[model samples]
Target chain A: MSVHVAPLKTYIYVFLALMFFTVLTVGVAFVNFAHHAPKGIGNVLNDAVAMSIALTKAVLVVAFFMHVKGSTKITPVVIWGTLIFMVILFVFTGADYLTRPMTTFVPVMSQ
Target chain B: MSENSTLAHHFDSYAQQKESASLGMWVFISQEIMFFGGLFLAYTIYRWRFPEAFAYSSNELDIGLGLFNTIVLIGSSLTMALAVRNAALGEKNGTVRNLILTMLLGSVFLVVKGFEYAHKWQHHLIPGPNFQFSGPDPVHAQLFFVLYFSMTGLHALHMIVGLGILAWLTAQAAKGRFTPENHNYVEGVGLYWHFVDIIWIFLFPLLYLFGRHHLT
Candidate 1:
């Protein structure tokens, strides 16, 4: 098998993009849309936005910096497999917490 | 048919040897994901249980320093990528240069993290009996710091290991041991370094930016 070398420019581009996304994540955090929408939904939207940008940056690093885009056939299988299991773990565990009934853990001392 | 001495005896070709080594590294990384995944799961459970406290606790962290470290790690990943690129192209000096830069950036990250940790210590944010927070639920806030220290501490350990690998790679590059035809060692380390960076990519937002909307 032959080696596929990524050009220098690609790495530079990815570096810049990652930096941009990093700043973008911070920038998004300071912007609040809670006044326009329901408070709970707005907060969730903000968290989702931040995480989505992070996911994009992770993909760029994996595909380009780590050479996953040009990697051997078996490599992506491992990458995808790891990702699937991670999702399963988080999703399964999150289901219990997200579905749990709300309870007041602190009892009022004066009530 | 081992053209390269680095090639193992059981391998049929240099390419096969390289491929297997790369795969082994990825498998190891996958295991690492599971390792860190457990911590993330714990974080999620606690955040779900005490969202308000988690949000307030996250705001107590210094975003400026967190952002700075993110850039530093990203810069290191770029240098690591360049090191691999130069190694694969048989550019000896370029490989050495990038390897040194990567190591420097990695060290800078650790130093900044050390200072951050020290700040936490001074403020008694170490999440124990003396822990202090002005947040509504100090117990839940302490839980946030517990996750914070464990996750970032684990990530820092990986950076240290990565620095050691880069140091070894720098020495090897200085010796002109890698060539366009045989630089799987460099490539393998590149994968490890990038995987570390990816962990921080997720970590930066989760640890620092997750509930930051409360700041505004």
Candidate 2:
């Protein structure tokens, strides 16, 4: 019932990859997309790129460093379940605010 | 049973015990994800509502410290993974050495983070009465700092807890409690340490690096 331990070299590679991604993210943050895109679009592009990179790094950490890659079947299911729940939580809550009428708000309480 | 006293009687084999432990840890981690998810959602809401202010406020953060601490955390994760690997190899000294190294690296991260917090205090970045954000919308800037402190503070709390676990594991390693066949505890700790590192991975981009382009 012992888990399959990753080879020591695998751990090293994963660490190096993580470090590389970290530097990459920081480096990419310096790029000025404002030069090529409109202000709002540029900010979105910047955020999208940075976020995509961060998500990739996160996957590396979870799958390799955390040994989720070769873990039991149930482990991945639990992991996916958590991820799905998070997506639902963020999307639903975010959509509510994102789609709201900018002018609509409850009146402030009377002093 | 099987000359390994660590094996619980309920488990049919060492593998069963390890599997059970792994499953339990994953479940716990899932719950932790939800706990932090709420915080992330709050951050998303505020960021959506006040993007410019959030970006401006983020620029005030010490990117140098943030980057350095990011590396420190990644290095700690490596050391943590090594500790578990050493345990799986049944090398008691190796496990102890790596665990100590991991703890030291985690401490370094916290120390740097402490300095960053103090710097924020001196700069009046705290989100209370003394808050002083010099950007266009100081009010919304306060929102940024609120999320920043809350998220990173929670993360630091996890690091402290992880350090405590590493200390305990270090003691166990010194006692020769971990062998290649019975090192689930070490693996469990590795999962936790790596998870903490993952949180920082997202935090680095979301909080520290988000508005850096404007500054440059």
Candidate 1 per-residue lDDT, tens place, B63-127, comes to 99999999999999998899889998889999999999999999999999999999999998887
DockQ of each: 0.58, 0.57
Give candidate 1 misplaced runs (Cα > 4 Å): A38-40, A99-111, B1-6
Report the lDDT of model 2 for residue B169. 95
Score each candidate by Cα lDDT: 0.88, 0.87
* Cα lDDT of model 2 by residue, A17-108, tens digit: 88898899899899877778876687688789888988998898888877778777999899999999999999898888878755422212
Pairs clashing in candidate 1? none
True contacts kept of each: 0.85, 0.81
lDDT of candidate 2 at residue A53, scale 0 to 100: 87
Per-residue error (Å), model 2, residue B200: 0.4
Please give, for residues B86-204, the per-residue lDDT of candidate 2 as tens digits.
89878899999999999999999999999999999999998877777778878778878988999999999999999999999999999999877789999898988888998898899
Clashing pairs in 2: A1-B15, A2-B15
Instruction: Let me know the TM-score candidate 1 reaches against the reference structure.
Output: 0.93
